[model samples]
Target: MTRSLHSTDRLPASARAGHWNAVIAEAYFPLDLTFRDAARFEGQLEHSNVGDISLSRLCTEAVQYERHRHHISSATEEQYLITIPRKSPVDFRQLGREVRCDPGGFILERGDEPYRFSYANANDLCVLKIAKPVLATKLRNPDRYCALVFNGREGIGSLFTTMAQQIQRHASSDPNSDAVLSRHLVELLALALDRTSEVEQGAGSSVRDAHRRRAENVILRDLSNPDLSPEIIADAVGISKRYLHELFAEVNCTVSQFVREERLKAARDLLQMPNPGQMSDIAYRFGFSDQAQFSRLFKAKFGQTPSGYRAQITAACND
Candidate 1:
């Protein structure tokens, strides 16, 4: 069930700092907080768990938040949060990267990393907290996206922002529907990130990274094509087969290995869905020739059979 946590007027201003700090800490993570108006601190947070992700709407006056190394070391789970401001901009600094994220742009943050995120005035924030494993399924290396701002005002980004707003507006109508909506939001986020990553890769100074990203994107879009191969991918990405091999070698993997891992991760994500269909269908969707081969490779990578893994996660979600 969804819930709201707010600081009330019943408590005098002098006593609200601890309460507000505790509330924010539990809702997101433990952070050193200094309110712009500590004596008159005002904040309200509404949050819920959407499948394996956490969705929250945080409205608060000006404040400075610092996630110190101590807090980062004490954290038990690794998560990534997408923070979208409503009116003001947030100055987020992490891992030698300092980013100023304004409205219509979202910041991707890592829970395991120490960072400072502060806004000057009162601000409304939309945050989606996703577990590392959940996000890793949609990304090759999730850490690379941290502390970066992706455009949320056009195309897939626009759709993703619109979906988050809708979910925030109607998350509690029905528990079942909320779960499904949450899943959709996550899917949209993955698409937005996937697209943004490709663009950034292409724009970077390294032509090798750009070619690799192009090739990877092609492989992702055509995962279901059994005829997919290094030659097809190289041609589609406008690179020679030898050059493609060299590029992937930089990542210490071959084209076939990359394809296999992407398919397996995709299949793993599909398996965790509330309505994951027949195992054979899932396998075929990821371009596996047959269910038997898919099951063998899946077990080899994840150390469990597909059915067994799904049953385990299903039971865990229910619990």
Candidate 2:
């Protein structure tokens, strides 16, 4: 569905501020909107939903939006916003980090967290709001990417931004196609985040970060090898076995647990596909020793057995 709201619509200038507040709250979530000049402040919001994800283009005067603790307390599910500024820069503070993203760059904001987002000048912005689970299926720890600016001018970032704009401009009327586009958008975003070097900054040290990334790459490459253990991963990355364990520990995850989770995520992705092949073959393909173990682990991670998850996807598609 597609709809738009503008502050100028039939309301007196004196009432625009209060009306604007409601307009924005309906577009996104409830927030405190402080307009530089409330009576004269102007804004326009165009919004559409493609599948479960929402795309909105906001054009507004200088304003600040604050998501307070009370707002978060009322949220049903965690969400993330990827904002791309077009005319001016935006200042965002969340999760103890503050950042200013200019045109040609984008920043992420965690919706379930208290945050302050503002721009000093009028700005045209494209924002994508997606539920946490939708993105988590493609990227691990989506929260860590918040408050970081990503290049929207090149490579995967370029593709993602371009596609978002296109989708907002020509949102499909067909729900099935919209669902496919939504998945593609998420996949592109996952690739963009995966390829970014800034993601490793969480490790706290350059050398350790590089080592951790290298180790993760090796693990991803050898995920199909049932014997792919920490020792093998460490040896391949030219790091000591003990050091490899230490690196993973810093992230509060053990090497084995990380491997298992990645495998489960991979299996889940396959299950979502139209033709995921046989259950036993899918299990063994991801290095699971047997179907029973795969089912147990998949259920533990995703709260559903592999077959059940597949059936759920199939049912949704049929509907």
Candidate 3:
């Protein structure tokens, strides 16, 4: 597999900042920048050339920036923008709520709204931009998932950080891997959106909690059966397929989808263990026909090919 590597130090001054701006615009709302000290701002930004889905990390020096309503055009599409600050602090406003994001705090932005963000001193941030249409099609209610804050230090926020780090690692190794990474990226976004909707809707019994639990148990018990599916599980639980589908509708996922996800998760865990079983053995145990199928599904679910994932785990264990 051919891979492309990009390091910030290798880019010119203008292209570094411009590249960052382009990623921001693609993932969130647009920004109209009025630099107070352009010459004073120095940074390096590196991005993979994967169209539609791009991943990049950046570090910027002291600078002032303003994002306004004028930058958002009526023709603009909706999307989700996630900002994870690695250093310094950032201040931004959304719906009249002023927020000061500390290091490691995540800032979520909506592409359909107008907002402003500013940073002082040197700062480093990791960003993930998701296409709006893609997200909307995946969620039960897309509008309700926008402009939400996720605390990076705990809970689901921590999951996002883990995913970001994983992506950065794979992306840094090979640019062609973006196609695989994008799938994991989308799954993470879906999980984030689902959790955000749950938070905003307030705490209820968690729609379909019982059904989801039952389905999860079945998945865990029968992970080695590739034939396991929503219909089979629903029948085992004495529920109709339609009812089972309705149950998962609350979380914006289907029964079969969740089953596949759980299987993939189990595979990942097994592969990460010390002296993980042989690739073919693990695949067979996890209900996959062969290593090829296992690798394909693993890449789709975790954003890295199975071999890549296994090698990473082995390297970490040796270290």
Residue 84, candidate 3: Cα error in Å is: 0.7
lDDT by residue (5-117, candidate 2, tens digit) is 45556678889988888878787888998988987888888889898799999998899999986787678888889998999999998645677899998887878767899
> Which portions of model 3 miss their true places by more than 4 Å?
1-30, 49-52, 74-76, 172-177, 197-319
Taking the tens digit of each residue's C-alpha lDDT, what string does model 3 give over 282-305? 888888878898889888888999
By how many angstroms RMSD does model 2 differ from the true structure? 17.9
Which predicted model would earn the best lDDT?
2
Cα miss at 154, model 3 (Å)? 2.7
- Show the colliding residue pairs in model 2: none
Error of 2 at 203 (Å): 8.3
Quote each prediction's TM-score.
Answer: 0.62, 0.64, 0.50
Models sorted by lDDT, best on top: 2, 1, 3
Query: Model 1's lDDT to the true fold?
Result: 0.82
Report lDDT (Cα) of residue 120, candidate 2.
Answer: 99
**In candidate 1, what are the lDDT values of residues 217-298, reduced to their tens digit?**
9999999887899989977875456557867887899999999999999999889889999999998999999999999999
Better of 1 and 2 by TM-score: 2
Error of 3 at 294 (Å): 67
Which residue runs of candidate 2 sit more than 4 Å off their true CA positions? 199-319
Misplaced by over 4 Å in model 1 are 197-319
